[model samples]
Target chain A: MIARLLSAFALAGFSPLLWADALTGDVQRQPLNVSAIAMFVAFVALTLGITYWASKRNTSTSAFYTAGGSITGFQNGLAIAGDYMSAASFLGISALVFTSGYDGLIYSIGFLVGWPIILFLIAERLRNLGKYTFADVASYRLGQTQIRTLSACGSLVVVAFYLIAQMVGAGKLIELLFGLDYHVAVVLVGILMVLYVLFGGMLATTWVQIIKAVLLLSGASFMAIMVLKHVNFDISTLFSEAIKVHPKGEAIMSPGGLVKDPISAFSLGLALMFGTAGLPHILMRFFTVSDAKEARKSVFYATGFIGYFYILTFIIGFGAILLVSTNPDFKDATGALLGGNNMAAVHLANAVGGSVFLGFISAVAFATILAVVSGLTLAGASAVSHDLYASVFRKGRVNDKDEMRVSKITTVALGILAIGLGILFEKQNIAFMVGLAFSIAASCNFPVLLLSMYWKNLTTRGAMIGGWLGLITAVVLMVLGPTIWVQILGHEKAIYPYEYPALFSILIAFAGIWFFSVTDKSKAAAGERALFFPQFVRSQTGLGSSGATAH
Target chain B: MHDLAYKRIEQSPQFKELVAKREKFAWILSAIMLGLYVVFILLIAFQPQLLGARISPDSSVTWGIPMGVGLIVSAFVLTGIYVQRANGEFDRLNQAILDEVKQ
Candidate 1:
């Protein structure tokens, strides 16, 4: 399918840049580059084929939601890694490393530490208990309709904030690769991702993710090795050269004030660590695997792959500083990077292995965006179709065929919503938007999910109220915080000082859950508490749990 | 696997021990990892110079480099240990309890 996509790209091959430049009314010094388009077309075709295959067989809600829970440990591991490493992580994180040096490592560490905690606390238990969503686990012993309602809100809110950042990043990547207008690229990418989920479902999404992961890991390794070779395999020389070229020099090796104060640091730390555990997309990946064992194994493999990838990113960033910084050809007439800092890794690819490799990396980067958006869209679709339509509105009376239709319809709605938001965000300064997504996931979803599993006294009223409180606090504080308030809103002093609201919002959620649950002496609360033991046993042992039935 | 069998297992002494051990172990590991990460954040937020201190006079390598690498390595190491226990001790005891109940 990727090859077919490449052929299509080749068909649109000539004068693509000329047309784009004409529309933008800007002429470029560089000529039209067909190789990059070829590589991008090539990569996407593979996923299109995977989507075709996954769509043909999957007709039921189970298959649509969790690939009928048949994905093996290793494949699921790659998919998890694929889902976690968004195009932002590929380009934006690398760009952070390229610009701020050690601050980037701090960011990567915040992401890496979350995986072990997921393995230790979540993976197995989450897999055993929940058939489709983590909301399943949270609602198992509580009021199903209310809990699912609360969590669906939480999930969709996360998907929206996260989807905006992803859409922007995807637009940027496609613009770089295909030379299409940014809005045009965003729509194309959005439509393509929707198709992947709308037809292919989880199975298609999973394979696309797996393919992207392999491509990314191999692409990064090739670049990193070539980088090391340039310095004659001497690590110290690479660091020393980086220090020389980087404007910040020794300061770049330190924190460099990217994480200004204590509250912000703590909140950012909490958001990054716990946020991974809360993300509906990440949580939903566990359902794709058959059992608890495969679930944990997938986490293990994902942790290793992600950890290794971050280390490579660290190298790639510094490597860019050493090579791309000094090279005049990579610079614009104004003497800055050609496409700003995020292009550092792409420039590094061109520097190390010439245009072919640059095309290869760019294609992989575009594929990375498509794969991630598909996963996010599927999670959003499931939140609507399964959690809302089947469980809430229909009260679980809906059959598989109708539920599958809801999912497909939701995918198209979300795709259009994403494109609309993508265009609207074009003029917005959403630098903190990614943090807001993480903040919401950490504050709202994490606290509810964790307390619901660990604390038996958690009533439905508590979960619902606490989750909304966390959600409200995160959104409000993020809006009032310095990034948006001072910068975007044109305000003087901000109401909230910290960049991240997770530390405080999380506390609010926990306190609310505790206060509400403890004070409730009602019969419903008693019944909810009584249900916890059965839920706990099923979560642990898989005894009488919802085992996967092949569709 | 009937509800009675599950209820019996849940009420058993061995099952109680397994639950206690696993949760305790997970909490401890989580605490350790979280604690280390918090310390790193503290150092970044407060004692920047300490993290900025050069590891050796001769080289450009700073404390943060090895520290960052060590933290990444630690994430992998901790995961390895958990997987080891899950595959070995935890799974074994879990199977034993299930087999005992079945018998």
Candidate 2:
């Protein structure tokens, strides 16, 4: 079915090519170099081989979905980094910092901080009750049907938003590098992503992510080092140079100089920070590990790796600022502003490091989009096949083959949907979509997970209400917020003042859970709630052994 | 298998003691997060001149950037605390849980 759909889409895209060519009067296009073609072929072969290997080993549903629950701490750690880093971290944030200066670093800081919270609070519990999806943990104490339904909603929301961002990024990169039409780029990315996830499942996704992370980090690190060398290895001097280059005596060292509004600055920070913990694709990686200790260790490694990556981005962004300020060509290029800030990092690497760096950075950027989209597809598949179909609709009776079939189908469907959205919203900023994903995740999923794990009095009623309220509040705020309303819809004055919605969603979710839990006595268990408080208290004081001995 | 693992951990005195300590630390960390979030919101709401006095416009130092840096630092510190605890106390607890599950 997916193959047929791809063929149809490809044909449609090609139909317009002849007309476009005739109108342009045969302008000679630059052909793909031998090296570029070879590299592209090699990447395809490696990814496909991994998928085939995973398919052969997946003897059961669990194996296909979660790698038979046997992943190691270090491997999962690398995979976590692979999964979370995405194109947004590798490209988007760097581009943001390159264009906006200090405000761009705020996004990096926000994402990096979520690891500690996950390690300290959520990791072990999630592993202990691990099923195929996050809803497994939330539903462990609640009714299966309720948890499954809510989990599906939350997962879908997150995956849809995240996938659109990645697809849009892929389209832009394809256009930039290969000169492909926008629709063609979208369809190509969608097909490739579906092939990766449908064939290999978790094992394939994990390996892809790990390989992408290594390449991405190494490539970015190399470029950053080279960039610093150009600056004569002077870290302090870069800041001074940046300060000297500013147009309006803008504060180079403060957030206030970056933007005019204080409220927007605070809201952006809040979205980035809290949104990391709530990301469904990220949390799902916890389940891929064998145990809780592994989960915790993975967080530690990911944090370290991610931290170093952010530091490198600082160099990359600042280097671009310096380079562009001096170069007439880059200064005249309006692509950065029109295409959005996400292109700044790539443009900088291309300009400063030459064609070799441009090709390498572009390849890594492509891989970044691929790895993240694959992860999102897997997460979405799990929510559909594992949570919704198997657990709720089929009562877990769906056999291994049937489950795999359903999951693959869902992956293809999702990929197509993502491609459609990407083309439709090509002009919009990918970061905005990413931020919306985070807001939805934090608002809808975080509260339910936190309350269920810690608050014993959290009844089924409370969980449902909290989850729905969070989902609704986040969606509404995002729709009415300035980014979508004023900027996208051209409504001069948006109803909601804030650009970020996580803060509002977080507040609404917490309030709903507390209010609902306090008033409902029938379903609430007082003793369980009391025990959780002490357990939480004890965990904080360094009393508990980190080792996950099955008590 | 699941019941046996649960029982083994529940029976271990060391595991019980560790759980208590971990819970305490969790509360403290949560409190810190809540407090930090409050201060962040306050700084955003009221942009005082004192906050920007030392941060020159030439360098891009504002209340928001410093506060963001602070959050990042604190997050790392908390992660370090978790690592120390895991290496020391939580290691034993996790081992106990694994041993029980394996048995």
Candidate 3:
């Protein structure tokens, strides 16, 4: 499928690479790179083969949603790691470290610390209770229609914000790396991701993610090892060299101006840690595993892989500062990197292993974006089909075939929506976009999902109202906050000063849910409370849980 | 399993034991992780210089570097411990409870 698409583009005499160069006055026009195109095409062909194989096994709705719960612990681990390690993290964090050293480590640490919390609190129960989406678990003991409606809205909002970030990042990165036109890159990513989900479903999406994870980990490991070898495996030498070459000098060794005040730091930390727990795509991965045991094991492996990846990224960043920043070949006439700081890791790949490695890393980076967006599209589609369409609209009367059709249609819809938004927000500062996604997940999804699982008194009314409260508060405060209001809206001062909305919104959510649940004395609330024990038993023991279908 | 089986399991001593032990264990481990993370964030928030302090006079490496790396390693190690115990001891108890109730 992708081979045909690429050939069509090639035969059309596409010249967006030259067009982009003409628009940007400083950047020189890069001739179409043969090696990068070859490597990327090869990757797409291999994944297309996997999608073909997976489609054969994707007969049932269960299979479409979760590979028939057939994935093993280790494979799911790699997929989870792949899904979490987006191109944004790979290029964005390395770029951050190259620009401001210690603060990048802080971001990496914030990202990894969320994994253990998810494993400890959510993973096993989620596997035991949910079928395809987190809404399954969130609505397990409550009013299915109401709770599913709320959860679906939460999922779509997070997915949309996250998709925009990934799409824009993918377009810009591909434009820089492969010298493709920006719009062509965006369309290609959208169509290809839709293919992975629309035909192959979760089965193929997981494989694509797993393959990308292995490639990215190996590529980063090579870069980090070569970097260490240059300084003879001495950490101090690497640090000393980085300090000498970096413009900030010793200031880069400590915390800089990236995060200014305490409130902002705490809020951002809260969002990163808890936001990870609430991400719809991450939660959906648990259902791909057969049982609670595999679910737990996957998180363990994912944590190790992700932690190791971030550490490697830290090394890659410092190495880029030491090697790429000093090289005249990597720099433009303005003394900055040709494509900007985000290209530090790419340039370092060339510096260490020449253009061949650069091409390989670039291909892996593009694959990383494709894999992540595919997973996000799958999760968002599940929210629509499994939660809203099947459970809410049909009132659980929908057949397997109809549910599956809705999800496929949703996948294409989401794919087109992502591409449209990607182009629409091309000029926007997307740094705060991911932060907003995390903040919403932290504020709305995490609070509702957590309280539903643990708090027996959580009535449907309470969960629905409180969830909306958190969602609204987060979006409103974010608009009024510094990043959007003062920076994006051209306002003089932010009504809400903090950059992150997680701290305040999360508090309001929890307090609202508590107050509402305690005050409700209705019969429906009583019935909801009565259902908690059965739900709790199923959540803990996996009794009568959906098992892996026999192939 | 039916509602009766769920009631039986809920009342069983082994089920209660598993729930109490596992919940206590998870919460404790989670507290340790979250507590450490809160402290790390606090240090970054309140006293950035403390984290920025050099480890030794001879090296350019700062205290913040090891501390950040330690948090990452700590997250991985703590999850390892939880998984080890959950898959072994907790699973054993859960199986026993299920077996008893299945009869």
Best by TM-score: 3
Model 3, residue A91: distance off in Å is 1.4
Q: After superposition, how far is residue A277 of candidate 3 from its true place, in Å?
A: 1.5
DockQ (C-alpha) of model 3?
Answer: 0.53
lDDT of 2 at A215: 86
Question: lDDT tens digits, residues A344-452, model 2?
Answer: 6766776777766666776776676788888888899889998998889998787877887888789888888888898787766455666678778888788888787
Instruction: Note the DockQ of each predicted structure.
Output: 0.49, 0.26, 0.53
**When only chain A is evaluated, what TM-score does every model earn?**
0.92, 0.84, 0.92
Q: Lowest-lDDT window of 10 residues in candidate 2 chain A? A: A16-25
Evaluate model 2 with DockQ and give the value. Answer: 0.26
> lDDT, candidate 2, residue A546?
27
Between candidates 2 and 3, which one is better according to DockQ?
Answer: 3
What does candidate 1's lDDT look like per residue over B8-93, in tens digits?
A: 88898888988898888888988988788767766664667887888888778789889888998898888878778877898888
Where is model 1 more than 4 Å wrong at Cα?
A1-32, A483-493, B42-47
Better of 1 and 3 by lDDT: 3
What candidate 3 gets wrong by more than 4 Å, as runs, is A1-30, A486-493, B45-59
* Model 1: chain A TM-score against the true structure: 0.92
- Predicted structure 1: lDDT: 0.81
Pairs clashing in candidate 3? none
Clash count list over all predictions: 5, 56, 0
Considering lDDT, where higher is better, how would the candidates rank from best to worst? 3, 1, 2
lDDT of 3 at A152: 94
